[model samples]
Target: MFKAGRTAAPRTRPTSMKIAMIIAGTVIFLLLGLPLIVQIITAFRGPFLPFGVSSAQWGVTNFITLWELREDFWGVLGATGAFVGGSTVLSLLMAFGLAWITVRTDAPVRRLISVLVIVPYIIPPIVKAQAYLLMLSPESGVLNQLLRLLPFTGDVPIDPYSFGSLIFIQSLTNVTFPFLMMVPILTNMDGSLEESARVSGASWPKTLRRVTLPMLWPGLLGVTVLTFILGLGSLEVPLLFGQESGKNIFSLKLWTLISSSSGQLPQYGLAAAWGLVFLVITTIAFAVYLRATRNAERRASVSGKGFRPSTMRMGGWKIPSMILVTIFILLTAILPLLALLWGAITPYPVAFSFDAMLNRTSFAAFGTVLADPDFWVALGRTVVIAGGSATLAVVVATVFAYGIARSRKTPWVKAADLFASSSVAIPATIAGFAMFLTFMVLNPYIPLAGTLIALIIAYSYRVSIAYRSSYSATLQIRPELEEAALVSGASQLTGFRRVVGPLLMPTVMAVWIQMFILGTNEFTLPAFLAVPETRPLSMYIYAMINPRSAQLYAPDQGAAMALIFTLMVFAIGYGLQWLLARRAIGRARKAVAAPDLTPLSAAPGGGGEDPSATVTIAVAKRRARARVR
Candidate 1:
């Protein structure tokens, strides 16, 4: 009877567990999967639907019309190709140089340069566009004025509104993403291969050419593909810089088709067609990216044994290299910030002469911004929405990751993982459009559109992939600890809360901060879903700079708002860093004070336990002590 009872209990538990996993997986699929399904249906519904209409007759007319609009379509595709290619190449070269210098060379002020390299990414891309516009504007640019003062210089050659200028500015902003991606790969790479080549009579340069670059090929390819995809989908940079120059890309074209300044009805079906085309392109690129990443991971097999790379001494080139890097940082990071400050204070764009500085600077624009009650209300609304969205996203992602991690043997979990991972490849414009249609057209009874809740849902869809990735990595922690807790008479939920949660806290905190920053800076979804009362800071700044708006072309006021927004983001980021640092230090101190339970087998006249056994016993003892306390 007892043997039969034990067998039955085990079978029953597995069945229950499988049922729970199935339910959770189904919910996640519906939440994320339904939007894409709706988008496809909407695309087949053709370009015109009556107002407040939820249903449309299915046809292939939208695709046919899109094919007929080949002139505009081809032009946008060509421009997108050039922009994505130029930005990707330039960013990769610059990021490689910076990463090599910081990670492998003995350069002066390397730490400062390392910190400054990420500044461009930290500032929102919209603000980056505004800063360049201030500095490179042909009529009132400070840099152009300084150039005109030079001998034999008639007019400044820089054209801020040109396609070349668009690529240059966008490259500066996009470089940091690849830089961050490459630094760790370069830093942690095994140096034994290069050292062996050098020892075999190869010169340093030859060794690097033969050994280092080859080993880094996979990583480089992965970063290149990823950055190119990002550049392909970028909207704000091209929207701000290329819109006036008649250099529209696919994203901008999609935006124009769906949003009419002249009060013409929006061509919803045409926009859907563009999105479908873009989706196909992104899907192919993303597949390539995935393959490259898998290859990189497979190739990155440094031995577990300790081995540190040797740094190259720059000799006489150190100072010069450092100076060059410093100048680049100043141009990319500091100059943009200074431009924002200058724009905020001046009555209008002015040359950076001493007279202009002394006569034109004031706090009037900032004061005007501060005095607007709508500005305050918008700021408050943004804080709440961004904060709430980030928190909710972290929770949902953690739950989803937990389910996937614990149920890895189940086919349902595998399907869930694939769906969540593939979500990242969807462009923000497409995701926003899908969400917009999902709520506003397909399920209007839900009442999510034009509210903060809708914005939260959109942001979560965009950011949950990041959290899932983070949590999945952390979930690699062995399950033995949780099993130990279970054996000690705790329920499964209690074991997770007590044993796993604390261990995962650091990763959870990091994900929360990342999601918070992404939500704060997000613009695309808010543009699609946020009503006027629920607009975020990104939309607020966009309105100030929008040419069609009645804000009197106040780039100065927009600059002021940008400066404030940047400071707020910086503060939140640094504050969290400080708190995490302090928490880590506190843990170190507590660990130091804890009793050392080194096995007695290591002492004289003690029972001699095997080394492996001794280590296991010590760990068990420590855990027991922790439980007691």
Candidate 2:
């Protein structure tokens, strides 16, 4: 029907869609990238507002100020290096051990251990620090109180403020990320290579070192880089435990520069200069990881054929491995949680005594915390912040994710993806500082400083996270579904809404809950922007125990507040998980109850059998397994 020498008109998106995409791209860039740009420019300038505010000359005055604090800077750098390095090493060791036992070795109660391992990850960083503070503080610390019971040990045996304690407590939760990273790698790794080495007379350790580890180099490197980066940006642990031990960290220095409470104006340039160090370090580390990943991929272990992942027989080591895992779980998660409970129930800090716990335990602290009007106000504000930010992040991320997945070659859409992900390298601390500077610059025009809108906007830095998750989920779905909807006379937006949205619901909820938890627990952004009226629960808890807040410092009441907060978080997490599981189970049952009809000629056996029926049955079984997972 086409005429020769006539060209078909090119396909083009509707003008409305094009304009919407442009607006979205602009907003994403402003929301995510503008703050960093503002901070970078501020670093070059003196202590003054940006955007034509009258201030000092632009030079390396910030660097000069840094030089003036070189003595303090170097010491903080050394402490930071030690803390990050030590925590990285310890976290990797623990994570790898747990992953190996759960994935490769025949360990008892592997399922239970796997679930227990992630428990600490769910606990807020500040809560974990507070738990240890209760357990290990030299004076009135539960552990020290118990230690003094020994006749031979007259003085306190440990100091919670030491670097050793700092690394240990940080490693407790930091282990979860590396553990998550390694689990999939180990689960899918081919066992044939290790088997061949073992059959060739290599010892288990030799085979592991030469064959298994080399194949896993890329994953190990990725985990190391991420864990190290997390360790570097840590704020709560160092702030809580490092102060008394003189272990001033880089993050704390940045906090001090911007949020100094000694009746002085904030040194914006100095804080930005300090924050820039994190940006630089993260960039270099990420570059190294990319190069290493490419080289390591040359020796890929997984393939479509001959891929066998077998669990190792623990043999005589089974009991020891089980006992060791049990002890690790107890020490890392259970003990710390119990410490919180004890602190909450007791009128004051005391060693664990069953007699006293039964006879003298009081819910008075819980009652006191619950009775405060400020507590209720903080709780309400936290819920709104978490819910609002999570919803906004998911929406923005979902739109960008859909565009990136659908329009692979579109330049503007590709740029939109880039702008959205540009914030991933910026840690919460630096991002918070940057937002602080940005709001100050725009305060005259926007008047959003110290507002809930400011906190919500700041927390949406996790849009990058949500985008990554949604993008992966979106890619798994075939575009043909959308095409089919469009062929049936639906608009593009309608097709996406009716076809793709249903498929993405599970991923959407997961990302939302994750961002929600993060928003609830994070205090760095709130630390800079929150005033009294807008302060959320995490900031409230931090202030409660802060030594500077002498009048507000009440460890017992803070313990009660933190315990309640932790319970609420856990309830939300597990309750939603349970609901999702129930929904999946119901769908699976319906899938099984449904019947199918197909031509016998298409069946494999071809003896009056229906291939469609077999497929339906197999799909139902698969859904069952997915629910279990």
The number of the candidate with the highest lDDT is: 2
Model 2 C-alpha lDDT per residue in residues 192-302, reported as the tens digit of each score: 889999999999999989999998989898889888877776788877877666346777777777765857888888788877866888878877886899777687888
Off by over 4 Å in 1: 1-31, 48-55, 149-154, 198-209, 295-298, 315-320, 409-412, 594-629
Error (Å) of candidate 1 at residue 134 is: 0.9
lDDT of 1 by residue, 495-547 (tens): 55566667677777777777787788877777667777789888888888777
Q: Estimate each model's TM-score.
A: 0.89, 0.89
Runs of candidate 2 with Cα error greater than 4 angstroms are 1-17, 145-154, 244-247, 295-297, 354-360, 409-419, 587-629
State how far residue 300 of model 1 sits from its true place (Å): 2.8
Which pairs clash in model 2?
none
